[model samples]
Target chain A: MMSAKQADRLATAGLYAVAGVILALLAGLLGYVFVKGFPMLSWQFITSPPQIFKGGGGVGPQLFNSFYLLVLTLVFSLPVALGAGIYLAEYAKDNWLTRSIRISVEVLSSLPSIVVGLFGFLFFVIYMGWGFSIISGALALSVFNLPLLVRVVEQSIQSVPRTQREAGWALGFSKWETITNIVLPAALPGLITGIILAAGRVFGEAAALIYTAGMSTPALDFTDWNPLSPVSPLNPFRPAETMAVHIWKINGEGIMPDASAISDGAAALLILSILLFNLSARFVGRFVFKKMSAS
Target chain B: MQTVAVPSRVLSSQTHVTALTGPELTRPKLETDRLSVFYGDHQAVSDVCLTFKKNTVTALIGPSGCGKSTFLRALNRMNDSIEGCRMAGEIRYDGIELQSRQVNVLEVRKQIGMVFQRPVPFAKSIYKNVAYGPIRHGVKKKKELDRIVEDSLRKAALWDEVKDFLHQSALRLSGGQQQRLCIARALAMQPDVLLLDEPASALDPVSTAKIEELIGQLKKEITIIIVTHNMQQARRISDETAYFYMGRMVEHGPTEQIFSNPRSEQTRQYISGQIG
Candidate 1:
């Protein structure tokens, strides 16, 4: 019985209401976490290793391990993901094989992290004799991230306006030159988005690392410049417990006196750092696009 | 507005068609013989044989789906990138069989550069856009590159408008300016034949006039083959016109003769606006 104009307004209101609810939920969660955890996050808490005997020590090694792990995973996976993406988007013919590959990528991206963690445990950690080390952990995380990265890169490459590629060809630029100069540069913003998203996901991930990296950072020395030494943060062969794994392990043990405080501070740091990464990604992506495109 | 009035010449409207190649084939700058293009099972362009004299502009005119663009792309082997797209026949350039496996397509492309319908200035700076081709072909000295960039830009008539902002992105330029930048970029390659696929169809009247004028100037140096749906555009810019209909080359003759006195009833009907 209502007017069509009224119905249109109602639909518009419904969409905005849904959007508001989502924003509010996100804001409330972040506010609650900051209030509870900010006071516990001190420079000393982050720089000093865990006080196992007394319960008031810091998460210096775990924090360092998280950054180290993220870097290693990216170093291994980015190139592979980027190459596969370019091949899929630019080179592969539209056939059953190419179709199957796309389907495989989607399937891989949606698989549960825990299942991947189990695969890592059996293959990279046990079968490969990596013994729950940082190397094993990085490899596991690479498998988890590669599919998403590939999809992002492929879609971006595909999205590069067809006219640009045609222009390059018309100019007598070889296919390789065109791809390297035009397609890859044009896909920068999307690549940055993919990197930031993969990094954030890897930062929050604990299940996969737990199976591959194991529990406990055994007295890492930030001063140790030697990359190969056992205690150095750069030692990939050494056992490493990243921040997410530390939080999970500490809460489960329930033995430390200030366990709640430590967990809260860690969660606070995680959320804040993720927020920082997201913001910085926008700036970096824009900077790269502007410089590359010269606009 | 230096408009050159075309003095129309008339031919019989008997619809009798013949190949335009005279018995005294002086080994044209570029020639295609029985060139056909097929996309999988469907024929897109068929049996197009023509000779393009050096330093003359030839316009390919047709209705939509008449394969003018396809034929234009075939000239530069730009269609090679399309999957399931196949070409049969020979395209000769400077007496060399362009389709032969021995000919490096990269070299061929450098000699026969092309511009597209929409302006596709590289996402790079204006200076870089023109410089890219020369750099790809191994012109490394900064002095040489600078000279080439300036000359090409000047030749395309975009230098004065963009000379100050040479370092700025070409994308910032107006559409007309961007299209000119693309022309300069191709000119940097110093191609023998410049293929244009309706390069002004997406442009405004002013831009179209500018491009038409540029084509007139360019025809004094490089052989040009342009495809356009605008019948007036073909008549105004071209010395010769080839009409395409339903994937076949229907007629080829002097532009004025084709416009005023077409030998074919279809051509006459098409020109008089009775059919498209």
Candidate 2:
């Protein structure tokens, strides 16, 4: 049999090898994407609209649509997810109903985004008559977003030590008061990290948006800032195409002469934005945790 | 080893029971009758009846899992927060039954605060930690909160060390200082009773001595109930001592009587380190 020291060394080397393989894979993927797409990126390429039969097209509306859809998705999802999470973490008893709810959330979170897209298409797009619009895309995204958010919130709240709650109760604070003041503040870091990560997912989403938000953008008047105006970019009822959807569309059936170039630039921009989101999430989470915990 | 003789105010068995229950003229500050605490089906504390007089310290000494901590927690209804935990007993404060539905638990907790074995200071500034209790109770004025914070910290014997940087996070303080901050947090509510569960066990010797000193000073106004594993701790700080064994109070009397002249065989064995 191998000696304990030999076993330890072997285990350490094996772990390092596995870690190195993962790191190399990630680096390789990122490098390939950046190398192919970075050359196509330019100010004009980003700001101009897509061409039907021409060479020079920008992703300005699609980029705006990505962020707008993300904001709208959060607006639809965060409150309901937060409430459900708090209930599951703090108040729910170990009963059948709560157990089933937990199981359902788990199953729902594991479901494919495409399935959620179809459901949103059927329910929000056609049934609710919010056809091919940002609103429908947002509602569909919420279906995909809610379970993950609820789990994040529940785990974050549970991460707080039991002693903290006891301290609150010892001070004669009500249950709601304790949860709001002590628990939420302590869980803020995790909540912020979870939210921004979800935002990144929503920002990069294409499949759900294709079915619900439509594959084309309506002509938007740049000066028309009114949300109620049909021609306004801010109008939720208007068809909006996100950057990811644009990339997918151009690659699949584009008539533009520079479709491949535009796709490469959009893909690069999308990856960069997601990377930015992840980095910011880490920075903000750490900053808030430090500020709140003072350690 | 030089040992000094401590004068024993040891009372007879009859007189000791009478003393614990209190005389008609001096009503007990708090009393628990047939207090049995259970976590689900497991009984942790069984039929513990005790009386606490005002302006005095009573220490519950026992081995691990002897229900000393459970009994202490039950006084403030802290056990209510634990899942599957329940209590069957009457806890009276100032002649009012606290266990009754008529009594508001929040008000009881306000009047009776507890300090835990490990200090639990909120992840906030020292000043904010102390002011949190009073703010919830409607002491919202800036000046009043400031005054209350200072007064509570002073009472907890933490003001001298933390006064200069009260705005600093309580988490940054030493373990001893954080414990004191927790005490100060509870004291801000101006509670009549203070429950301490091994408040110094997690601290160093010097911090423990500071906590013991603080406890001695605090008993002048607050009815303090402490659960300690250290027999010496119970001897040094408490006016009354109750020895618990296997979820039962084996004996209780003046600290001197219980220590030097115990009535029960188990109490004597436990005291002598022969059995725990």
Candidate 3:
């Protein structure tokens, strides 16, 4: 039998080995993808629209669609999520009904994205007759994102110190004013962090958007600033395939000469954008934390 | 002017007895008629009848969980924010029933400001923290707000230290400074009555002394009600002190009487540190 010190040493060594393996696996995956994909990420490859069966085209429209869809989903989800969160954290009673609502949010959040996509396809696309448009996709994405945003907002609001609330009440602010001005500002770091993380997740979403936003990108004119035009990218009714869906589509069905190269470039761009999002989120969180606690 | 005629040496005689319990010319500024507070099934304060006179500081001193803080919160209806917390009995401010149906809680709170135990300055600039109350009440002009902020901070004894950094976030201040900033924020409302919930308990000796000094000076302007655990602080800063035991007011009179002359056995035991 080994001595106690030897056993402790063995345990520490084992832990380090496990950590090393996990780190190496993540680094290897990212390194492998970037090494293969970065070369194909050219200016020309990013600025022009995708070429069908031929060769070199860009991802401008799909990129725009991804950002637009992300913005639209956030616009719909943020308010509902924040309001529900505030109600849950600040106003909800400890009752059966409140518990049921909380449990439902948890259940909805844990549901598979594909399942939500199917529901969106059934309800919005077929029954609602939206017919695979940006709005349908945004609605499904919002549904997918609502539970997460609500949880974040609820936790953030809950984390604000009780003394702060009492101070506001003591200063004669109404309940709503206290919530909007004091509670919201104090919870800013967490709220902004949650929003950025959700944006990242929404940016990479494909399974749901493919069903609601459609896999085919319609013909578009970038200069058509009129929102009602069929070809305007801003039109919510138009089919808008995002970059993640574009990658999935190209990977599965492309027969072009440079299909592999296009996928490589798009994959690199996707990972790079996510990294940027995470970095910026960290920066904003730190900035807000400093502002709040510096005194 | 009525009180100034009495010599300090003669206050110990029978002349002071009626001065404390008798009818006053100003109706005691604020009065609580058999006020009681209950949290769910637990009764924290039971029938606490007391009066706070204008231009005088009264300290509520008791052991932990004796409902002193609860009693103070009741004066401004601060306990209303706590769910399942109920209060019975009338709280009158300037002859108007504060607990009445027609009374607006927000309006009552605006007139009666509070400073909490732990400092709770808003996570904003020093100027903003002090100016928030006045601005929210529709003092929109920048010049007016600047004046209020400076005047409030000056009253709290903080303007001299933070004069240059008025626009800086309040979070950067020291613990003592933050507490003073909270006092300044309350002062900006120009409240007629100020309630302090162990306002100096969280501070060091020096900061405590500074706050005690400010409180002494402030009693000349507004009716001040403070809750504190420190017996010495109670004696040093207030004109009258009420000793609470469990959920009841054990004894209340002039600070000198409560500290020196024993009325109730419980009050005597508590003052002597026999029972907490």
Candidate 4:
């Protein structure tokens, strides 16, 4: 019922208001993180192990542990996720079974991360009796990552043109051969992007690792590399501490004087790791996928 | 019209004057005994029986929704991929039943390749797109694959235009080039029967002429079946023509007869520009 000029003015003001709020929120978060955490970033704070009273305890061990978990989770989850995705997208017919499985996957992807952590704790820690070790943590992270990986890979494979599949078939190739040679290669870029994003999620996870990997730091033992041994050096059965868990523990106990410092260091490291993963994913897509498509 | 001097044998005939018939035809390389296609409850094609002679171009001409493309797709079992689409009756290629459940659809597709109405080149390099099938079927040697890629491109009449940029992405090509690349991809399998579903309907006039010329040359090496709505194209490129109306083949014979002396009233009206 307003005049045309008045209504137009109101609409423009509403659009600007929404944009302003979003920008303000983003800027505020970045400013707070930088101002609170930048002062604690130092060589000693990065390299030294944790101490009960010292303000600048190093995070070297925690950083190493995070890397270990990230690599192991990716190694275990990538193949299985890609395989399941290819099967669902390329081989499976659109029947009741496939439809149900697809719906289940969509549901799993949206479930809370904390819930996934709880399941990991039950299955890998208590049931398997692995205790607080890197193995248990990796298994937990793998479970959390599997559904996401599958969904991404499935979508990428499905995005490929039907004609490409038909072209392969016309060349006398079987379904398996066509998927392996044609479909998978074409979908690699999107698959890698999903893996990188999943890795970021795993690197930042803390709640799930709490019950599975524990907060206790172990002494370095290079000779205990035997994977079969229950107390092996690399075994997740031994208590392991990651950066996110360390931050949580230090902050909760209120014992460490530089709790803010530790949190800042952990947040920065997490951000850096995610950034690196995304950059590398982009690099791979640009060079490798481009070459593959043109080769 | 002026009547020429009749031969002595025709003059000696007592009963009536007989029109001259076309040349005798050979056995068909691919034949359908009684093909019927259904999409769930609705029937798409009904009791279509036809034969395609070896190394000859056959055209299935029809109006929209007349099931010409459906029949063409059935030749390669491409229709099998569609949900709720079912086919009854027998389609045989070289005396081998293509519709039997036991028969491998993959093998049938390999022997009888298909080109769709639209150009569909994979998002891969021109060379790789051409080499994709050869490699999957256990062609391990790189040198052999390279040779096959070149040969197929040459056969598709796209070799000279694409030879220098073999490593370029297939998507970077023009529409006409992309369609030709699709043809090359199909020919790489060395299929005996080539099924084209309005291959040139999506291209420009120049591109259409190029495809028509390619079809003429391909008949020397493979049996060709084309579905087209263009009657002039049917008369120009096809040796035999089948006019489909309302999911049924109203008339089928030599191209000259189907165009000039159709046997059925429906076909006569259709070809004379009186009805669809």
> For candidate 2, lDDT tens digit of each residue in B149-259?
999999989999989988778889999999999999999999999999999999999999999999999999899999998989999999999999888888989999999
Using Cα atoms with residue i matched to residue i, what is each candidate's TM-score against the true structure? 0.93, 0.93, 0.93, 0.88
Candidate 3 TM-score for chain A:
0.93
lDDT of 1 at B193: 88
- Runs in model 4 lying further than 4 Å from the true structure: A2-13, A42-47, A91-103, A221-236, B1-25, B272-276
True contacts kept of 3: 0.67
lDDT of 2 at A265: 86
In model 1, which regions exceed 4 Å deviation?
Answer: B1-25
The CAPRI class of candidate 4 is acceptable
Q: What is the lDDT of every predicted structure here?
A: 0.87, 0.88, 0.88, 0.81
- Residues B1-276, candidate 4: write the lDDT tens digits: 222232321122322322222223444678887799999998899999998889989999988899988888888888877779999887866555576545667777877888888898877899988887767657889899999999999998999999999998998998888999999988987788899989998999998998999999999999999999899999999999999988887788999988988889889888888877
Reference contacts preserved by each model: 0.81, 0.65, 0.67, 0.70
lDDT of 4 at B141: 96
Model 1, span A1-295: residue lDDT tens: 9899999999999999999999999999999889988998889988999877577788888888888899999999999998999999888988999999999988999989998899999999899999889999999999999999999989889989988898888877878899999888887888898899999999889999999988877777788968899878888988899889988988998477998889889889888878787899889889887887673
User: Which order, best to worst by lDDT?
Assistant: 3, 2, 1, 4
Ranking by DockQ: 1, 4, 3, 2
* Candidate 3: stretches off by over 4 Å: A1-11, A281-295, B1-24
After the best TM-score superposition of candidate 4, give how far the Cα of residue B234 lies from its true spot, in angstroms: 2.4
lDDT of 2: 0.88
lDDT of 3 by residue, B149-226 (tens): 999999999999999988788988999999999999999999999999999889999999999999988888998999
Candidate 2: fraction of native contacts reproduced: 0.65
Positional deviation of A14 in candidate 4, in angstroms? 3.1
CAPRI grade, predicted model 3 = acceptable
